[model samples]
Target chain A: MVVRKYFKIYLRFLSRNIQSSMEYKVDFLLGILANLFQSILGLIFIWAIFNRIPTIKGWNFHEVAFVYGFAIIPSGISELFLNNVWLIPTVYVNQGNLDRILTKPLNPLFHIIADGFEPHGFGFIIFGASLCVYSTLKLGLSFSFLNILYFMVMITSGTIIYFSINLFMATLSFWLMDIVSSMVLVHHLSEFAKYPLIIYHKAVQIILTWVIPYAFTSFFPAIFLLKKGALMLSFLTPAVAISVFLIAYSFWNFGLKRYQSSGS
Target chain B: MVLKSKIKKYLALSKINIQRALTYRISFLTSLLAALIQLFVMFYIWKAAFSEKITLAGFTYSDMLTYLFVSQGINNIYGWYTTVERNIAYKIRTGDIALDLVKPLRFNFARFFEVLGISFVQVFFIIIIFTVFKILVPEFRTPKSDLYLFLFLVSTFLGFLCMFSLSFLVGLMSFWTLNYWGLYYVKKSIFDFFSGAIIPLQFLPLSIQKIAVILPFKSIVFIPTLIYLGKFTIHESIFQILFQALWATALWISAVLMFKLAIRKVVIHGG
Candidate 1:
């Protein structure tokens, strides 16, 4: 019942964002144009790389695009819906906005995550999804009922992993009192998920898998979607999702205990 | 005599700015870490090419690595001081620019020098750490030639000019737009792609490359890095430097005209 209530609040918050965005129609439309152009430019980089070479370590353009597209979909959606994830730690540490959020009836995390809503990101998400669909079809991969179910589960899991990683970084504000550059680090690491994990050396592959679990964000999803990898570990998607969600919540709770709120 | 006072004031402001930037040790260290990750990703991409027995267009492993390091270094130096720019623009839009306009010091030049000084502290630390890591890490190979060193410095300075002018233009948008964020966002997106920051420009298609070259973007990063890799002859390097200078002059003039016009607009509209 609490979850349902929060969902309704989120829906209302989203409508408010749309209303606010609508107030500046010309600027918003220009933003959409710039965003679409930027995303297409990103696509051109991938196209250029593939045009030069047949494959990078046995991962063809289609497979690589699959990874890029899927990773971008979650990233774009996250940016569009939860743009405050980009700025929460800064606000939490610098302005002690957390104090204001703490006094509110809504969950502080939900409030922070809903602080900014960027409709421009939805364009990128749609573009990435279409690319994903086209790439899957081009690879002659047949999507069955089970595969569709698995894909949906894994993508959600990927989103959770991304969120948890970012929250964990934000939690460091309790100690370091700043997380802007740390967020930049996370953004850069996500760029690596654009290509095949195998293209990297064994050490890097280990880092991605064991240290950051970036592989779960794209590599594992691509592996399953392509049906080239073991399905046994693939079914563990929900487990991974649950673990990451728990980790983020635990870390945030712990950090809250230690947070020395800036007296503003 | 008045010029001497202006120079003294600029120097004093720059010193304070640089000192404050140096105090942010964690931000500095993380920036270095980000640079290292970028270096490694480029290295891996090139390494994978070697493993696959594929040559990257015309670039060899050495060329690729050198390009990545130099471009990465240049990017750190040229990234916009968006907060500073926004603050300045905000003051202008609100008529508070009159206070600075009346100050004995040249407002824009003072602000430029202040940011340049802060960047000196950050860029110097970046260079030292990069040098130590390059000598220690095998993946980093030093670019060949004294010409590269000379051209790299030239390119970095000109790159800063191009970006500064572009940022100034974005700042001018505050006059008519009432909010400069749209302009800032657009500037960031264009610079990130065309300046060889996110992905190498060489990896972009021939048509895109042609478009990028004609813009101020190539002058921001790629030209300098490519020159450093011995990819250009002495004549070409000289020509590239001249090109950067010409573009910088053009942009600087544009910024001045825009600022003058924006002042009139702001005064009339009470923006």
Candidate 2:
């Protein structure tokens, strides 16, 4: 019942955000167009590279495209719902807006997430899903009902991983005072996952899998979906996602205890 | 005597900008780290690309590494904090641009000086990183001749002007648009692809290379990087540098004209 109430509040906040965003229709459209253009340009980059070389470390164009497309879906979901995690340092911690949020009846983190819904994220979803469908068709992959179910589960797990990582980084703002650079570093590191993990060195691959676990966000799950082996490891994504989310949530609470509201 | 005093005034403004940039030590470190991570990623990707073939589009492994390092370093030096477009858009949104217009100095020139001041600090950081990488990485190459080095410096300066003018014109679009974020990303995408920051223009298909040659974006990274790598003959380098200067002049004029027209239509709402 409590969760249902929170869901209602979240939906209300989302609708209000959407309404305000729609007030500037041109800006809204342009924002979505920009994201679509960016995703297309990324595909073009891959295409240009593949034009010269047949493959990069045995991963062909379509395979890389599948991974890249899959990667964006999770990132887009995070951008849509949890982008406020990025502003935690500057807007909430430094500006002491967290004090206001703390006074609310709802959970502060949930409020932050619900309040920051971005419509531009739909552009990412559209482009990513289109690319995924195109690549799957081109590759002639047949999906069963179970496969479709697994795909949905994998996407959810990937989104959870993205949110957990972002929240973990944003939680540092409580003590560090400014965590923009750290957050940017995390962003840069995650960009590597857009391509096939096999192209990178074993060390890089290991770091992405174990330390950062960005690999599970796109790579391992992509390989499994394509039936390229590593099935057992790919299935671990949900477990990893759940654990990471739990850890990140606990860390945020721990940081909240130390958060002495800044003087604005 | 008047010209000397004006130069001093701009220099003073630049000094203030430099001090302000120094305050963001954490940002500086993170930016450097970001560059290094990019270089590392490129290193591995290019390594895999070259595993089977010794050369792709006349770039040997070492040559490509050199190009990546030099181009990335130069880009870092030329990088601006919060693109001029977004800065202008924010100022316009907040009505701070009205105060800026009241100042005696030209707006673009003031911004140019501020960016130049930040560039000085960025160049310093680039030098430190370059030196450390040179010592550690055997593949990093220096220009073969003093003439190439001289041409590179000239081309890079012109490239900065070309990039600044383009950004300034984009910033002027704030007069028409309520939000500049979309425009900013679009502009950045064009630069990343056309400027050869992500990949050398030569590696691209012939049709795209032809298009890139006509655009000023190539002068920003492609031409400068090629000149730095001594990929062009002395005469060719000189011709490219002249081309860069030409584009810089043309873009600067266009930016000035756009700003003049745009400022007249500036509607500062909700001040």
TM-score of each: 0.88, 0.95
Tell the DockQ for candidate 1.
Answer: 0.46
Q: Which lDDT tens digits does candidate 2 get at residues B1-271?
A: 9989888778877888789789987887787788778778777778888896788888899999999898888777756463677778888778888898888788888878877888888888889888998998898899989989999999999998998889889888777679898888777778878998888888788988888998999989889899999999999999999999999999999988888777767643422
The true-structure Cα RMSD of candidate 1 reads 3.2
lDDT of 1 by residue, A181-240 (tens): 877787679767766787787887887776777777777777788766856555665677
Q: Residue A140 deviation, candidate 1, in Å?
A: 2.6
**Model 2 vs. true fold: TM:** 0.95
> Per-residue lDDT of A146-262 in model 2, one digit per residue for the tens?
878888999999999998998999899988866889998997787788888888878989999999999999999999888788988899999999999999999999999988997
Candidate 1: deviation at residue A17, Å?
2.7
Model 1 chain B weakest 10-residue run by lDDT: B78-87
- In candidate 2, residue A87 scores what lDDT? 84
**Candidate 1 residue-wise lDDT, B1-271, digit = tens:** 9879878899987887777677776676676677677667666766776566535767776667667777777777743442346766678766788887778876667667777777787688778977886787665666567767777788778878887777777766665554456555666678878887656777776788889888887788878877777788888988988899999889988888877777676568653
Model 1 residue runs over 4 Å out of place are: A26-41, A85-96, A103-108, A111-116, A172-176, A254-264, B28-32, B80-96, B137-143, B176-182, B196-204
Provide the TM-score of chain A alone for each candidate, in the order shown. 0.90, 0.96
TM-score of chain B of each: 0.86, 0.94
Query: Each prediction's Cα lDDT score?
Result: 0.74, 0.86
